[model samples]
Target chain A: MPFTGKVLVCEEKVHLRRLLSLIVKSLGQHVLFEAADGEETLLLYQSVKPDLVLLDVNMRQRDGIQTIQALKQIDPDCLVVILTSLVNHLTAEECLRLGAADCLRKDLPREEIAVQLARIIDACFGDIPA
Target chain B: MNVSDQPSPMDLKGRKILVVDDDRLNTRIIRGILRPQGYEVADADSGEAALAAYPQFLPDLVLLDVVLPGLNGFETCRRFKSLYGDACAPIIFITARSESEDVVEGLAAGGVDYLPKPFRAKEALARIRTHLQNRLLLEQLSKANAAKNRLLGMAAHDLRNPLASIRGLTEFLRDGTVGPLSTDQLDLVNNIHDASQSMLELVNELLDVSVIEAGELKINRAPVSLTALIEKAVYLNNINATQKHTRIVLQTCDLPQPYLVDAQKIKQVLDNLLSNAVKFSPSGSTITVRMEAGANGCSVSVRDQGPGIPKDEQHKLFKDFGRTSVRPTGGEKSTGLGLAICRKIMEAHRGTISAANHPDGGCEFQITLPS
Candidate 1:
């Protein structure tokens, strides 16, 4: 399966978002949109309608897990991957149970990030860019 | 460690009693003895019936016949003790045999007291009353200890959140990342921020030691980039370094990749050590920091060209509030807890810390934290 569409990368910290966005772009995925928090994330998701979303679990107002719940209520086919620095088991389990595609801790190298994002994008779109 | 207002010991009302005996007349005799003292009484003819009565009657005390056939009173009492350690209400053994060995065996089987068949009813009642009193006191003491620990734990957790917030705000101020300030005011603010951070560090150390003493020191761990940690510590201490015209050089060896650890705690340890190095080293001298990888783990060393730690004082360096004669080179204030805190963090990480004079000159503080 190959994905040719875009991904919505939602994070709060400027440094983390910059580093992660570089990794996402290097993986050949288009950044359809970016949001600093969950409210912005929801509005962006509705407007962009990207193929996938990379979410930071700890965000202001509504968190990624709550945003995932809210998004699923609108679009059940949403593919959300939790992007977080802290990899707590409780959060990981909750994300998986709530229909997240997978969890990727922030410590991963750029290459691993690319590979993981590629897999997730392919899983969503059933194809990838050549 | 001391609770100013401790509660009084609890009191229990006199409840019912169950006396088990194979003989009907013997049971009657025991019932006659207890009935006069406000104790409602019941009887069971065998060990099986006595155990069955325990669940139904839920008696506050039990008198058992030691000679009952098939699951004797000794076995029944042992089972009762297992089900309830000191809180089995009160168990007294009554049997015809008065041999010293028989009495010893009866008490060993969880009988609070062994009474001869013709036991004095008044003495038996008094013994039962005393045992109940003791058990209530013990239960109260255990509850108090548990509550004290919980209160301390909550206070520490609550204190930490604000301390963290304060540290974050101070760091933002020191870095001038939040707003603008004049050169002199910036320096003043930096000093104030550093002092606040030192205070926060001491509070955190106190909380950590309390947690350790309470046997609640568990690491919340993650994979940590050693390079990143060193850089962050150096960045945090840059203000002091620039003030003294001193520099901390982080030299990287051909070490293995990053290791797993509690990054925040380990960062605190590194900051403590580096702060000490900067404080002790003379102005314009360089503080050398190097990392090395080993078969089991990794080690980080911070060396400063200052008067070395005296051999005699080294032994007491890690004791709480213990200070060495060596003062800070830049007139910096120390809480006298930095080394002790470093040792505590290393021990929690299942690692070790040591200080000694480097062959090149001055003293070197080394910490080997496990992966």
Candidate 2:
């Protein structure tokens, strides 16, 4: 059974958003939704109800902290993985404590990042029946 | 003495001066003298009154009389200094006691300067202006320095994201994440990866320095084996040393008991020292990491067999941006901030880091932590 789950990519930068969406797609047959800011991210998430979210910590209008709180409030069990270049220990810990599934640095080696994402996706969508 | 020395200070408004004199006449005289210079004067009849008004008025400079009804000027000055320490406003004792000991006593009590009784109008104004000017200048400098640190932190943070992008994307291209790359393309990708990686390291170092400068360097201590940390550092540095045909010989003389320390931070310090040894050493040379453990304290020293730092430049080793004339043999980039960061980390751990030339060969950097 192939898991074609919805994954929302929330990032402000266009190039990074594209790269992240592609990374999510590389995992499996996943429906990708891209949002440039937190507002759009919430709108898309509400309308689409993604199985997982790849959120950037820093954004223009609404940042990751506020957005993550709102997301968790919307769906307590929703998996929100923080993909950020804000590569600080404190921020990562804060995001994870705020119920982010994982806070991965964007600068991590591609293979390492791929493995982490694959594990997260498999956990969420792998057991789905055909 | 020229009662009318002609260095008139320019008028600046909202500059508050606190006048603490038992005599109402003297307070009025100081007020009359400084009002023309655009100083807002507040009067306190006694040392007790001055202390009471200090919090509200927050005067830039204080003119305190030695004689008071209670809590004499010296006592008040001492209390202010002890209470506020370095942040206490500059105090100048203006009193009838013109004896030389009186001047010394006033200064010893933390008064920045002293003005005699029946002070010359011009001289009194000049002294007040000087102290007030110094206080304002110091405040400006401190604020400017803090702002600079903030700007450095922000700029470094902003650079990190794009740098990460460049580094990650380059590696992905080289690793064939999307598609396989040709030989020439792979070479270019490697170049880009290396460039961005070094740049990222520099940016991170800058961030560390700024954070430390802003007094945000935190040490989280946990039980960590000193010997194990040293071994791990040696192993990590060896990976790069092997590429240059250099060897790191770790001589852990004795195993120390596991102690509470920020293990990650200690590891970083060790990594910096060992890598520096590897970076500066010639190919086919041996870099020795000798750890000496004992009851009172333990020290780990990284000694490299390359050209030692010059006597003149050695003193500059632990300062930020302290780049000596000594060049790396393996063409590895030196951030020059590594030692500075290492020093701060050591200090936070209540340890000390020092660099000195070995008798037999190259420079040795050692860090010692008290047990």
Candidate 3:
């Protein structure tokens, strides 16, 4: 079956946010919230409690690391996956340590993105019906 | 002054020299020898006087006597070094003793050269000239390297944002998110997307080269299946190969599984070789990949049926920006850094990458990794 849960996309770029929103919708998921920075992401996370959060590492005011920390504080078991163009090993490791589910590159192909998202969805819920 | 004995015009123009000796006769001899060569010579009778004169004299070079009344030459040299740090001028010690132990002690004390007390003027001048020239060359080299790194950083930082935007917008249009498009429009948009993606890859490759040159490229080694890595690389390059009607054939062999290596970096090496094979092979040609296990290690070769590299130009294949006479059969754009990056990765892994012309009629690029 299709995913019936909410997702929050926290990216600073408008075009990237729209593209990600489209990809999530195409994968049969609902994007309930969108955030441009860490402060907005934390505020949205408090109210929406999205099943998944796709966060970018580079953001204005606050960054993905701080935001992930705040999100984890709100809910210890929150699922946040980093989506960024910066291919830094240290940042990826730190994000994982801060309770991120995974760190995915923004330059990944659409098919790969869909497959990764589907895998994440499967882990959250049971296997989708054939 | 005899014409033959006169120093050359460029020998000592605007050069400053400081001579330190407890004997006034020795100091006078040094001044008399260097002053005619157009050098501004300053003399001191003791090590303490030399240290005091160092600040105001600011000589380009120092001639120090080993036997001083106070703060012997070795101690004076050490003190000057600590005070000047990197800017410390080259110091030549003047000693009456020519024993090996004395020379060693002088060198250990930070003196770059040792001049016997009865030193000839020509020899002293020659040593000074050589050291000054070497220092100048070193400074120039370091400055050039810093400037190059700065330029690379700015390019990587500035070019990535616009390129990503272009790629994102092109993908949006091509995916029909904006609207439906004609077949030709779709193809054009696809080409635009490919071009932008290639530009992004070039920028990333340049950044990798800079990182490698700066000795910061790190590899996380683990057990990885070679077969799986090769297959993944072939799959990644399948689209480009198909565009040119070229087929990549992977020849499997019974090799050990889960070799210790950096999976991501090895995959990069494979991807670069396969892509190069595809770019240089003619349409409807076959590219072969073969792997074998030997005593030294495992070797993987990618052979292409294209115009082989010329003998004279083969040495330059793995060098940075090394472009051979053989051009890409398909009008593909290359960063000219792919092979160089591959070489660096292989070296980091204690492996080797080499290219040779196949006897039958093509070029073969091989990578050998320690098992």
User: Which candidate leads in TM-score?
Assistant: 2
Looking at model 2, the pairs that clash are none
lDDT of 2 by residue, A3-64 (tens): 68888998888767766666676677888899999999889999999988999887778888
Clash count per candidate = 5, 0, 1
Real contacts recovered, all predictions: 0.00, 0.30, 0.09
- Give stretches of model 1 more than 4 Å off: A1-67, A75-92, A100-130, B1-10, B14-18, B28-44, B48-62, B82-90, B95-97, B156-159, B175-371
* lDDT tens readout by residue for model 3, B88-114: 878999978556677888899898998
lDDT of each: 0.76, 0.85, 0.84
Per-residue lDDT value at B283 in model 2: 88
**Between the candidate structures 1 and 2, which one is better when assessed by DockQ?**
2
lDDT of 2 at B279: 84
Q: RMSD to native for every prediction?
A: 10.4, 5.1, 8.4
lDDT of candidate 1 over B196-304, digit per residue (tens):
5666666556666556546666678877788888878988787788789899888877555567788888898898898898899898898889998878888999999
lDDT of 3 by residue, A15-109 (tens): 77776777777777475689988999999888988988999887767888888888888999998998866545577688998889887676556
Q: Single out the weakest 10-residue window by summed lDDT for candidate 2 chain B.
A: B1-10
